[model samples]
Target: MDGTRDPLARDERAELHWLRAENTLLRVQLDILTDIATGYAHDVDTILRLRADR
Candidate 1:
């Protein structure tokens, strides 16, 4: 008996594929957000340092 012929197995495989694709998308989004936050922090630090010099 081939596993592919089973309806339950096919549904599980479809769900697994969708979940993997979603996981990849979320990781990319997280990377973008992290870069934005890092840049914002650096900018704030530079502003504070410049103000302190005055």
Candidate 2:
């Protein structure tokens, strides 16, 4: 039997929307972590340099 004319059913559309939102949230979180790690590395380097010079 032929299925409904719509290529994407309602439930499929909702799931896709939810997945896209989740992906966006994760992307933002990863960006924040990257920035924090970068800052921490810079601070560690500065501390090491100061100790070595003294």
Global lDDT scores for all candidate models: 0.94, 0.96
Per-residue C-alpha lDDT of model 2 across residues 1-54, encoded as one tens digit per residue: 577586788999999999999999999999999999999999999999999999
Clashing pairs in 2: none
lDDT for predicted candidate 1 compared with the true structure? 0.94
Worst 10 residues of 1 by lDDT: 1-10
For TM-score, the strongest prediction is 2
TM-score of each: 0.83, 0.84
What local lDDT score does residue 33 receive in model 2, on the 0 to 100 scale? 100
Worst 10 residues of 2 by lDDT: 1-10
